[model samples]
Target: MRNHKYLFLFTIFFFLLGFMNIHFSLFGIVCMTLPIILVLKDRKKTWCQNYCPRASLYTTCGKSKKWSSHKTPRFFIKGNMKWIMLAYFGISLTIILMSTLGVARGVKLPMEYLRFLIVIPLPFDMPQLFDIMNIAPWLTHLSYRFYSMMMTTTFLGLILAMVYKPRTWCTICPIATVSDVILKK
Candidate 1:
């Protein structure tokens, strides 16, 4: 891990690898899943504080903005927004799984492109990088969906960091919400 000297590389690989072989996007699933597992076992935000590569990227990028010293907005810090984000995360994950299952069972659900908020498809296109392999189409679909979800969250985090403060997006991060609810941290 380069003794953690280059943490953003962890985050960048998911985005870049998918361009070469979309199946590499499946790594997003492990990143998505690990925080929950760590929180459940340790009852801590160790993942958010230390292991999250996107947080690393956001912090480095946000600090570069210089004008990002503004207070985090009330909507991101107060009330139900964090819970709402968690709900959106949950729903999007469910849709990804169910859609994959449908395709595995021979249903012809449309493959996801780069989605913005999980439901809204964005205009960017990806090569069908998995077509050369004989794997089931659902694997490729799942890979793309996971990549889109990761990108969507990373984009939101970067925007929040730019407009307010470095790591400000952590206030409403879905996994942070989960940790707070579970560990009261």
Candidate 2:
């Protein structure tokens, strides 16, 4: 079950679709929700071992046997970093929801600057891309917020994969940590 070659390939396929302007939200939604559902159903970190795309990617590309044989720092895996990251995720989600609702009500917030920071290096502005696809403006706004949140988490995963254990980020991942807690109960 640990070999996730198919999941790794699927992740690459999705990235290509994303580059072609597809939304690909269903995959993200599934990734976010399935771990919790599995934990509730079977009380295990099944997703991390057999299903997470990022974990698959790390296993395939992170050269963990060669580059990360050292024990991960205790703090990186079992310290305050996880809580801090979870707090950031919670706050970011709250702000994104509030900002999206504000857009629906024709209210403007200074969220654009923050959104811009989040979207850097992407070839197109998210709302405008959605506009081109004839999607509802409110949906566009929500999509941008979701993308921002995903990118933030991905960046953290990349950093963890580079410096610590290939799957170290999984230890502090909000979804994984939450699932672990729920499964323990």
Candidate 3:
């Protein structure tokens, strides 16, 4: 734990880079997919336990009792929270794919702003850090969607960390839930 807890900083770095260059948000794809792939290969939650940057962040914070330490309510833990997250994730993925496909088909879908929870668009738009004139519009759109999803989860995790034990979000994280569901069979 001591050796690897700092890996959490990658989560912070990811957001920083993503905000600077939305293309960096593509890295979220690795994060979102790697856990499930690792779990499938190892038949375990190896990503959550030893390598998840978000989990490392939680662990780092847990070293101090600075957080509320309240146990997650059974309402969230007994089953529903994970499912809700999974549904949210699934719906977001659907929107991302469908919209990107629409753009690719030459539909004039305006680039959407930073959406929280896949619905709440923030007032600010992502700035173009570098010239993207050569980049395909659909690719840009895809990056935006990926960034939003990653940000949404990070915000949720931070809120959960503050309100309960730092690792509370992990208990119901979509990746963790998906792993659980797959492993059950």
Candidate 4:
């Protein structure tokens, strides 16, 4: 029942805020990110062990203890950690790049779709694109609020990730949450 509840939450529209940069306002992003930290801090594997698709992938790829046929690796905690970390980082960077490029190019998804991207604390200076691309949106300038919000949330998220685990962001990340639902079941 809990799994179904999580799966359902992942599939819903509002929770999609985790995927985008401008969805639920800045405060909303923190609300979503906090739960992920709590979940990963659970040393008992309550979250990833039962819920993460990437976790399943790691196990199947012989990168996780759950799939090592009961024989654990010597560096169980540290072994191959970088690879997993890199893979997760790469995916995140790709998604952000693609979404930013898409939005900057005037690629219009539904407002709801944009909500997901908006909720994430996007790290890049999106407004700078106007000057860099030589585009003309001479009306509204990037507000101090935008950068402040972005930096604050992104910095907190990173600090949490570094202090806890490398891919701490992915734990409750809407993108990862969605992908896990799509691929795991």
Candidate 5:
């Protein structure tokens, strides 16, 4: 079994990936992030190292054992991971902002449906339940909104991984795939 810390971070990220908007209600985010907060006093790579699927996939891709030591020219660290993260996040955020604004202005772009699909909840039926309950509409709206952000971010991250390192996000991802694999081996 993995440590609680791993579960803690993964739960939050999974929750965000699945349900980010719920704006007016902190219930979901709170319920999800609580464990991470509790474990913050003794933070570790418990989450990223053992339980994350993304990390597992990357590890399966067969990286060089010394890949982390391969330094980029302008970096202080021996690894090129930092630059990859920076580029991915920067481009992702920029694209999200521009795409969102364009959508609001009725402009068309490729993968525009993804913008809607990402922000919207998965299973496609739960948000409507909130509407039936007459709960906060912002919660439903925000859930959809944040997902758009995450999709853009994750997509950009994936693209940057191709250009930079093989698994840049997995390197610092707060999930537990790595730790579990090492222990099991």
Candidate 6:
């Protein structure tokens, strides 16, 4: 707790900022990218160990013997699940990019249909929020889709943390996995 207190505070600040405006949602990008940056700086897994808001919160909640019931499943810790998750993310990103570009090119795509797959809706309509802020509609749509993706990933991570080890999801996190891979090269 002592080691992670500052990260916990920053996480709260980021969450509040996210609710206040769509632009602040770029914090998600920073969170996703930081692992890789740390790896490049030769501080591999620093974000997961010391800085990730979600990981820190999970540790506080589940680190105690009473809270953590089961050992993380072998498959989750040592099997192909991480690659599967990464592939899912890849497919989702491809769909989002294609859908956004389709909209930009005046080709109608059913974006609402994709949104239905998101486990949780964002707190606000990001496109509408951007409109109120006088930002471009296309960029708003892109950001909205990205935020939806982030929400889905966060929800999945929460479920995994509750069911398994505190940092079970971190083991298979795309960013963390990629960072480790890159740093091993």
Better-scoring candidate (lDDT), 1 or 6: 1
Better of 1 and 3 by TM-score: 3
Tell me which of candidates 1 and 5 scores higher on TM-score. Answer: 1
Q: Per-model C-alpha lDDT, please?
A: 0.81, 0.66, 0.82, 0.37, 0.42, 0.66
Ranking by TM-score: 3, 1, 2, 6, 5, 4
TM-score (C-alpha) between model 2 and the true structure: 0.80
lDDT tens per residue, model 5, 58-87: 333324344442332344234554555556
Instruction: Give the RMSD in angstroms, all C-alphas superposed, for model 2.
Output: 3.6
Best by lDDT: 3
Local accuracy of candidate 2 as per-residue lDDT tens digits, 63-112: 64555445777876668888877787778778777877888788854332
Candidate 4 C-alpha lDDT tens digits along 51-109: 54332322233322232143323342335543554455455446555554555566633
Q: Model 6, residue 165: what's the lDDT? A: 76
Cα lDDT of candidate 5 equals 0.42
The alpha-carbon lDDT assigned to residue 141 of candidate 6 equals: 60
**Model 4 stretches with alpha carbons more than 4 Å out:** 1-22, 25-76, 108-185
Candidate RMSDs in order: 2.7, 3.6, 2.0, 14.5, 10.4, 3.6
Candidate achieving the largest TM-score: 3
Model with the higher lDDT, candidate 3 or 6? 3
Worst 10 residues of 2 by lDDT: 109-118
TM-score of each: 0.89, 0.80, 0.91, 0.25, 0.40, 0.78
Per residue, candidate 6 scores C-alpha lDDT tens digits across 1-185 of: 23464454665565456445645656677887777888788656777766688776666555653654578878777899898888878887787778778777867543432153444443444333332456555555666676667667766776777778767788888887788678778
Clash count of each predicted structure: 0, 0, 0, 9, 22, 0
